[model samples]
Target: MNIKLSVVDQSPVHGSHAKIEAPRLTVELAQLCDSLGYHRFWVAEHHDSVHFANPCPEIMVASIASVTERIRVGSGGVMLSHYSPLKVAECFKMMATLHPDRIDLGVGRAPGGTGLTSHALAFPHEPHHGDLYAHQAQMLEGFVNGTLPADSPYSTIKVLPDSSPKPQLWMLGSSGGSAGLAGHLGYNLALARFIDPDNCNPAIFDSYAEAWKKAGHTGEPNRMLAIACICAETEEEAKLRAGTAVYRKLAAQMGQREDFLTPEQVQDRYKAMSTSEQAFYDHILKGYTVGTPDQCWQEIESLAYQFYCDEVSTVTVTHSHHDRMDSYRLLAKHL
Candidate 1:
């Protein structure tokens, strides 16, 4: 299929590890992936969440890029609704100044937190009255490229460290809602298939391609899909490790905040679940690619082909750090 593999780490607080160790693990993973030849290593942003430790992906991106030489580092993404687009552009620009072409500025419209936390993030400023995500995105690109309309109030303000290459801009969305906007504005589209597997299909890429063509873009659309995946030497081992992911999804659905459970702990919890709850867990598992290395690669390749995209970014979580690390190592052997 001639596809590239990437990573989107959520800095999960797993098993007995302290919350602080998650970010360190992200760096460790990035280093390993860099050496193993992963294309991009992106961190995630989450606020007020027990499962994920990274609230600010920009800082993590800089840290990861400093240690890794080749892989692209970026947010999976920055929630643009919470901050000014100019500030976001400046943050990425500063990183690009340090890391050059190795940086990516992937932005999303989601709040990245609970409603109360989302509200607090916008404190001191009046709640925005409308859907300004598109506007923010446009302004962000304008600021990044020094291309804001001449009449705009901020047109005269130039982003500093401007001589350095700019970070690649990406619109991150689970559904196809932002595909046209991303294409029309010349940003790459990274569909979070792991977040919304049901709606994630070739049509999203088609939408982006159509919009790109309509906007007079001259070449093929630049896009990728991210999937939740787990790998092990055997099917049983992979499914066992995936229990942690299934339990994490259950906990999130129930509004619970707990460290990621070990596979053993998840097994116990699964036995205790009612039949319906068990069904829910099984349903979540269906969204993930979990199996042996060959099994995972086959599905990932098929998905990339189906989506007409050349890159597939993986999001993997396991309670045992060794198992998690080994999963990527095994997957890399296929490459």
Candidate 2:
């Protein structure tokens, strides 16, 4: 099966470095992906955390677009629950105006940070629980296309510097329920396969495809499958590096949410894990791919075909920034 490749750079702020250097590492990595012929280069938004530096994805998107020539730059995604739909539309509208056809707006239901952070972001708006993302998504779509309902309060609001085209919108989720919502709304879906480690269920893809057609999508289905990847020269090295996530999962099980670990952190945590905690590694590593480039590509290919995903976006994290770049470079060479 032929599958396009993209990236989700989370700007993990780890290693023996200062926090400010994280953004620079992210920019350099994105530039490398752009030059390496990757289809898209997406950034993530994880606020109030020492692990990730990018809190506002729109800014990162702009920064990426400025330096790249061909690749699409986008959020992987922006948590719509924390902001106004009109504001999001306007932000991406300005982005589209600048980079026309080179921008993506991937929206998510998950709040990027903790509950307190989400509360702070949504303070004036007063967070509502049910159907918030669906509402925001619809409004965003309408504004992006100048189709806002006349009776709606935001009808009079206009996106400044609107242009001929707008950013392509995508819905990101880890569950079939969210997939169905994206389909019903006629938006593209980006499944967060990286997060849900236990679901090898192929029915999720079947349901998403069915939902796309059921939602009256006449054109071809546009979607992406995202997963974790770790590539090294040797399978042993890959497996060793892949244990970072395993240890991080164990840490999370122990109530620490900031679980993106560096190599040192992983080693320390792994040594301290109890037998039961160590047992969780098998389950945690299920969704991840780690090996030589050829081995890694085979696994990635299987995942893309299983989901019938048009594009595969990988989020690669490792102890060394150079190793992370090498992982991507090697995967590109083979994939």
Most TM-score-accurate candidate: 1
TM-scores, each model vs. reference: 0.96, 0.94
Output the lDDT of residue 252, model 1: 85
- Model 2 weakest lDDT span, ten residues long: 122-131
The CA root-mean-square deviation of candidate 2, after full C-alpha superposition on the true structure, stands at 1.9
Give the Cα lDDT of each candidate.
0.89, 0.81
lDDT per residue as tens, model 1, 20-131: 7888988999999999999999998999887788999989999998998999999999998888898898889999999878999999988888877777888977545227
lDDT of 1: 0.89
For each candidate, how many residue pairs have backbone atoms clashing (under 3 Å)? 0, 0
lDDT of 2 by residue, 1-335 (tens): 67899999899765646778888888898899888899999999987986678999999999989988999999999988888888898889899889989999999888777788876887776666435778888888888878788998878776875445789889888866677778777788888888885663567767777888897878866788888888899998887777766666556667777635666667677678788766677667766888999998888888877777768899887766777888899998964
- Residue 222, model 2, lDDT: 78
